[model samples]
Target: MAFFIRWLKAASFLETKTLILDASSYIGGHLFARLGTERAVATYYRNPVGNVVYFDALSMSLSEVVKKTQDITHAVILIGDTKPDSCASDIRKSHALNVESIISIIKFLKERHIKPVFTSTESVFDGIKGSYVETDEVNPILLYGRQKLEIERYLQDYTVDFTILRLSKVYGVSPGDGTIFTSWLEQIQRNETILCSYDQVYSPIYVEDVVDGIIKAIDTGAGGIFHLSGNKPYKRIEMLEMLLSIASEFILQPVNVVRCSINDFGLLEKRPLNVSMVNDKIVKAMGLVPSDARELCSGMIKKFYTNGAMEYR
Candidate 1:
């Protein structure tokens, strides 16, 4: 009995006052539902609020459910469904309305004075120049960017304690399948001509780093807009080459890669050439230096291929 009691104490240390994250709507959608992120986040969530009072922020009302949240000391929202290729109608009919609905949630948190943490993206900028700061001009070039920017603007003068962690290209493996990472691996294995664009340049952060930075923000009570990304910026081709090289080394097979321009792809949305954000603010705030792009990318590759992915044999 004494040994069991001591063991219980050690186990209980990992549990924090319950933290809530809505995902019924956001699940099976974006990077949030991916295996890498879900696995990394499991450590931070002991007795998660979703295990108890379940709520879909987009489908159901956040105001009612947020209040029903028990022992909710802190709430973190990690949901963003829209992207560059999202059609105008999809943005208008769904993504835009989702943002407006989240406002009611913000008000509920304000009533109880619970500081909310929101995830923003680097797409808010036009990417005319790289190494963007928090105060850089936000001329969003895509529908997704417009949606994120709209939310940022709504929170600016609300007299609420909130922290907006604007993220870069977050790379990780999907929980189920068909993530960009998996797709690249599959294409490489099949010896398909991978048309990697040379126009885009951005600092892609690892999912673990982003999750760690978020936990740090929650712990240290950091607020306001902060950029969290890898230490360096890289072109898409450069990054893809690194990924291919790693795969080649692992599977002992050469890859067929094709260098292409962004214009040739005929994409619906105009992608920003340089969406990388300066992580100086987040580094300073957390008093920690972030890993280099190569290191993060390599680690992700290894993890995703550990048990064999959709394509990596």
Candidate 2:
């Protein structure tokens, strides 16, 4: 009995040792600014046994993952996906920096007996579909979605010990700029007209909520697939309206918003109309509740105000 107990303790210790690699750390890059140092440390990662290392996925190859690193219980790969209306250069970056590199990283992690936690996107589905689940069919419309779906398929193979998080449209205050929310804030601050789609709909998960879900998945040792998203879906215009309401409390600016349809854009890729995913599986397993986007965005605005003012990148 004593020997069995000791073995269990050793197993538990091994599980706690993790190497969290934020390949695409921009989503929460400057979260430290808003969350402060100590709180950010506790929120971003908590390891009782092992050390944590943050490196850009593009900077290192799979060979470096094994050669450069020592012991780790698991490795989390949060990389990939190009921005909306990504150009040729952006697509190339997604392939070279994320898609290709992650394949090798997964193989390396598997060989070393380390769990691989990957972040996927809701873009895997064509926007016509809403309330997608883990078992739903994947039909990517954009290049970004297709690449992410390709990774998802690779990880689904029998040999990989992995956790795939299919995330919704992640919305939060980017410490830098260029995010949809930040861009809207920019136009609002300048009192300029903002044009957005009325037909488009998506689950807008706050960046902090995304971080929270990632931690929960790691702690629960979640394998296979899960959806991390907000409690509901909102049209692009609706979200912008909510943001306007929130901004009213902090800023005194009347901004003009012009609502258009998805057809307004004449781009190479046809954007998905509605690709919001349901969070039944993630919520049930992780014991997490879907957050209200409005409340979360309000919190983001408050955080920005507390830090003097929102700075453009």
CA lDDT of each prediction against the hidden true structure: 0.65, 0.68
Query: Over the stretch 1-313, how does candidate 2's per-residue lDDT look in tens digits?
Result: 3223323534764323344454225553433233333222211222222122344455665554344334454555665545656623477776875578778778777666667778888889997778888898989888888887778888887344678888887765755456667778767767788888999888888777777787677667777899988889888899888888887887765677788887787766778889888898988999887678777667767776666555421
TM-score of each: 0.78, 0.79
Q: Model 1: per-residue lDDT, tens digit, 1-313?
A: 3223323533565433323354332321222333333222211122232323555555655555544433344456664454567534476655644476567667766665556777778989988988899988999887878788877877787845678888888765544444455568767657677888898888877665776777677667677999988888988888887776775557665666778887678878778888888888888888646766566556657865676654322
- Predicted model with the maximum TM-score: 2
Best by lDDT: 2
